[model samples]
Target chain A: MTADLLQQTIWLAAVLFAIGFIGLMVRRNMLFMLLSLELMLNAAALLFICGGAVWGQADGQVMFIIVLTVAGAEVAVGLGLLIQLQRRCKSLDIDRLSKMGETE
Target chain B: MSSDSLLSLLPLICISVTIMILMLQIVLVPGDRLSYWLTVIGVVATLWATFFITPLLPQQATILLTVDAEARLFSQILVICTLLLLPFCHRIPTARGSSAEYLLLLLLTLLGALVLASASHMAALVIGVELISLSLVVMIAYPFAPQYSTALETGIKYLLLSGVASAVLLFGAGLTYIGLGALEFSAISQAFTDIDLMEQGLVLSGLMMVIAAIGFKLSLAPFHLWTADLYQGAPLLSATVLATLAKAAMALALFRFYLAADLAVLQVINLGIALLAILSMLTGNLLALFQRDLRRIMAGSSIAHFGYLMVLLVAISTLHSVEGAAQSRALLAWVIYLVTYLAATLAVFSVMLHIAPASEAFHQTQLKGLCQRHPLSGWVLLLAMLSLAGIPLTAGFIGKFYIFTEAVNGTLWGLLLTLIAASAIGLFYYLKVVLMLISPAEGAEADPVTGRWLTRLPIILIALFIVFVGIYPPSLIDLLSQL
Candidate 1:
């Protein structure tokens, strides 16, 4: 029963990862892309918790906590930056930030 | 059990204490320079502590952290770089007002990076990485100017990317733990030997994802898009720190992690890394060629340099010869390359800060008539640029020589060729900067900016070190081999 649950969790994480990857590739809006990234992180967190439970070890759980702390810090800094970007460019289009061009 | 092991931890403790004192001082005395002095004293003390403890460190201290000679060497380099960077924060107009706050963030970042240099476990690695990243966010956005929106944007992009990378890292850690049932690097290595190929694949994937996350931090090719904007937008002092110190720490962490992993597994990742290195080299150099902004040019060049460092990584990964001498040579080459790269980069940025106007425009025009107006600064810039371009008798050339020699000795002929070609391409832009320095000003008068002793001291020291290392790299090579 526990193995079945672990397998289910892995499948769910795979699904979430696929969804996030799709959103990252398809979304033109920067905000949506960022949201997609957050989804991917959430999937990773879920995977970590499930792995810890399945393995019955504290390492995965410790890593999960570390990931959570990093995630929180990242959001704080990233959102702050986004606000500044929005103020300057007036739009959050990721595609438009190609001012530093491939050749230039 | 040994006194050496306890003594080895002094630098970390000193830095921690310094940070606490500075934090307390900031709260106690709102407008005093005590916090600044304490921070400077802290960095210097850390440097001194690194020197004193180097002899007492055990061959290999613990699972979570190592006190090996290599780690000690790198720690000292980091502390000295931090010390040199302190006074520039004072002269750099943009980093004013919150000087104490900036110093605190820098010290914290240094602490984290020092930990990263010594990290021997996945847990320590994760903690060290996040600590540095958090402090970096604050430093990047510290400039309160209205135009600092770019800094804010850069910070946000870094935050999001870093977040994704951390999650990826955690997932990798989870997979590794499941496969090996241990978080210790030594245990993981032992477990890999017993694991079947199919299980190895899963563990390899986890390692790859973790490498990708670190690749983002290092700004390697596919992961490099955020660097230019961030460098351009960040305050010059913070940008210098980011370009030199932070990247070095990330590289060191990745190097150590790879060292602990199985070579066969690492071989599987080499193809992808080679491609990334080649792409970063070509793209970085090519993009830098037409850049009008000096900061962007440095950013592009940095990407190219990272490519060179990746060449060393690829060599270290694939070379399986059991000859300890050959391995030590490779390690020595890597250390020399890092030290030379750090010095050359710091010298260039220091000169940039010296010459830059109050507005910090960093346009090519601002550098007009530099040779005529400030001969000393011009010569320093020229020497640094030449070194960066890997010219003979410069530290850059010696560093590149060692790396390429190792690559050739390891018979990575294709990678060696790529490095050579990319370096040839890189020469154009380094020359471009030099040309701009020597070119006559069209209409605008050259602005004279005199720097204080504290500001000039680091640049001069770095300049002399570059020359000394270039001419006598064997001394460093010998020191590294003893480690």
Candidate 2:
């Protein structure tokens, strides 16, 4: 029964990672990309909790807590940046970020 | 009862208190010069605390943190760099409404860096890394100038990349925990010895994942695409802090981790690092050659510098035959390199901030006639550029010489050759800046305004340190050897 639960958790993580990667690669919206990043972080935390359960150890759980903290910090900073970007460009499309290139 | 154990946490405590006080003051009192001065005092106090208390900590404090002489020394340098940045922050016309928030974030970033410097555990290390990253996001976007759209975009890039890196770090941590059932460095080292090859592979992958994330932070090749843009877009103060303090802290942490880990089983990863080093050197120097913007040029130079540092790191990983003197010498060389590199970079950035027009335009042409108008600032910048180019009679030359010497003794001849070639390419761009500063301007005279004395003082001090260290490096080397 534990094995089944573990498999299900792993599957969920895999799905989340896939979705996040697709969103990161395919989506042009910067906000969506950030959301996808959050999704990726959540998947990592889910994996950590599942791993902790399987190993019967608290290290993974402790790590999950840290991951949660990092995610929260990231969102706070990320959204602040998003607001600034929106104010400047009135849009958050990733494609418009050509200012990153050398010549630009 | 150990002095080291108690002293280890002093900087952290001082910084935390200072951050709280600064935040509270910002909330209560109106944002003004007083708040800025408070923040500067906070950073200075932290610097003193780092010097006085850090030396007392036990050489290696706990499984998660080390209070060794090396970490303390780097922490001291980082504190000084943060202090040097204060005046620049004050003088620069901040696009953001409140300079207080900028100062607050800068202090928090410093606190995070100090934590990372002493981190001996994976959890502590990750936390430190994230703390610095989160604060940097604010620093990068703090200048809300219309031209700062690029800065905002770069912040978003850093945000997303850092988030992914953290997740990768967690994933790696989870795998390592599953394999070794522990997060402590010493236990992980022990586990590597007892575990089977497959289990070892799992642990290795974990380390590599963390390294990848760190490489992004360090601006090493394949992960350095974000550096030039971010540095270019951010304010001069933000760029200097990111390039110097943040990179120094991360590099020191990585060095300690490599020392503690079972490096023997990680031969492939070390080799991969060497390859990346070469690529970064070639790419960074080559790309920097044509850059018109000063910030982009510095960004490219930083990438190349990291390449050289990585060479030293790769050598340290492989040189198991030499235990005491050789190892200590290599480590000392790296420490000295970091100190000298930070000083040179900060001095250069300080001069750039002074010369930059109030209009916030940073084009190369703006630097014209600088030598005629402000001879002192021009000379300081000239010295800084020469030092960065590793010209004779400068700190950078000595640092590179020591690193290459170590690389040669370690038999990393190929990397050493590439390093020399890259340094030559780097010289062109550094000289280009010097040329711009010295060359006569066509129409307008350079701004006659001497920058703030507080700002000018640090630039002179850093320049003096560069020359002193360049001429006589033995004392600094001796101090680093004790680490």
Candidate 3:
């Protein structure tokens, strides 16, 4: 039963990570891109949880908490920057925000 | 932990206390002058501890950090670079009302770099990286003038891309943890010595993900799309930090991790790194040739230089068993390369900032007949360019010489040839900049660059130091060997 759970968890985490990565690449909107980033982070957290369960160790759980904290910090900063970016560009498109490269 | 371990972490503790004090100052007085002096005191204390105090204490501060020689050297470099960068903060065209926050964030970023340079566990690595990148987000966008809108775009792009890279790095760590059941560097190395096939597969894939993420941070080719833009758009202060402190810390962490891991069984990963090195060297130099902007040219140069540093990674894996001396020398070579690279890069950026104090978009043409106007700036820029191009009788040549010798000893003929060719290509652009400095103005003389003596002093001193090191390579090699 534990073996089956382990196998299922691995697949689930991979699928979630892939979905997040794909979402980030596919979506050009800043908000959705941030959501995808959070999803990717959660996938990693899920893997940490699975690892802790399998190994019967707390290191994985500790790592999971760290990952969560980091994600939170990223979101706080990302969203703050997003609001400012919105005010400046009047749009949330990554392509439109990239006016730096062409000027050179 | 024991008193000795805590003492060994004096540098980190000093920086943290400084950050807290700066924060409190912000709430109370909220003046840039007070905050700036406080930060300098804090960083100087950290530097003193790194130089005098930490050396007397034990090396292992905890499982999460180790104050070994490499960490000590890197921390010193990071702190000194931070100090050099602080002066530029006052010159930023931001509103005077809230300039204290910039000093606060600078200290925070320095603390992060100190943590990263000393990281010995995966958790510490994650924290260190996140701390640096997060602080940088605010620092990059701190300039409030409406004319600097590009800073906002740069900050957001960096945030999103850095977020993805961090998640990818964590995911890789998670996978590695599942395979090895360990987070500490020593424990992971121990596990790698005796692992099953299935676990090996998991570990290899995880390692690849981590490398990719690091490569992204270091801005290696194929992952270097954002680099030139960040350099061009960032406030000059943040750009200097990004180019020097952040890259050096990440590269040091990557090296320590590489050395700690039992990499004999990871030949494929070494090969992958070699491939990235070749691509970066070729692409970075080739792209830098036609760049009109000084910052963008530097962005390209950084990509190629770090690519050359990747050769050390390959040398370690291949040279470990045959001759241990070669492996150790490779480490020495890395230090020389990094020290010279940092010195030369700082000089280049400082001169650029000195010349174009108010503007971010520094065009190459602005340098026309610099020798006639500001002889000091022209000479420093010329020498710095020579050092960067690895010309003989300059510091950069000594560094490249060491790397090339190591490459030859490790039988990395292909990488050596690539290094040679790319460096030749690099010389073209570097010399072009130098030529512009001396060549007569085509149309009209550019505005005279004006700066206080405080900035001018560092530029001259750095140029002289570069020349001194170039002429006396033995002194540096001896210093590195002693360390």
Candidate 2 residues B1-483, lDDT tens each? 365575677888888998999888888986768788888777878888877874465565656677777677768877887887777778345665566787788888998898888787888888899888888877776774434546666677777877777777776766676557777766777777788886677677777777887888898998888888777767666777898888988888777777766553467778878988999999999978998887788889889988888888877765656676787778877888888788888887888776662333377776676778788787888888898899888888888988888898788889988998999899999998999988886776655585777668777888888888888878667766667
lDDT of each: 0.77, 0.78, 0.85
Q: State which docking tier applies to candidate 2.
A: medium
**DockQ top scorer:** 3
lDDT for each residue of candidate 3 in B1-483, tens digit (9 for 90 to 100): 777778888889999999898899989887777777888789889999898764554477778998877788888888988878777666345654567787778888888888988888889899988888898888887765535667877888899889889998999999898888888877776887587887788878888888889899999988999999999989877888889888988888888788776554478889889999999999999889999998999999999999999987887778988887878888899889999999999998898778776577899888888887788888898899999999999999999998898899889999999999999999999999999988976755555568777678778778987999999889878877855
| Ranked candidates, highest DockQ first | 3, 2, 1
| Model 2 accuracy (lDDT, Cα) | 0.78
Residue-by-residue lDDT tens digits, candidate 1, B1-483: 466786788899999999888888888876436776777788888998988986676545566888787788878878888887887766234445555777888898999899998888888888888888878877877764433435555665566667667767777776676666677776766788787785687678877788888888888888888888877877677788899889889988887787766443456678778887888888888878888888898888888888888888777666655565776677778888888888899998898876652344488776676877777778888889899999988889889898888898778888888888888888887888889889876765655557766678888888898888789877667766666
TM-score of predicted chain B, candidate 1? 0.94
The candidates' DockQ values read 0.42, 0.55, 0.68
Worst 10 residues of 3 chain B by lDDT: B88-97
Cα distance off (Å), candidate 3, residue B146? 5.8
**Which of candidates 1 and 2 reaches a greater DockQ?**
2
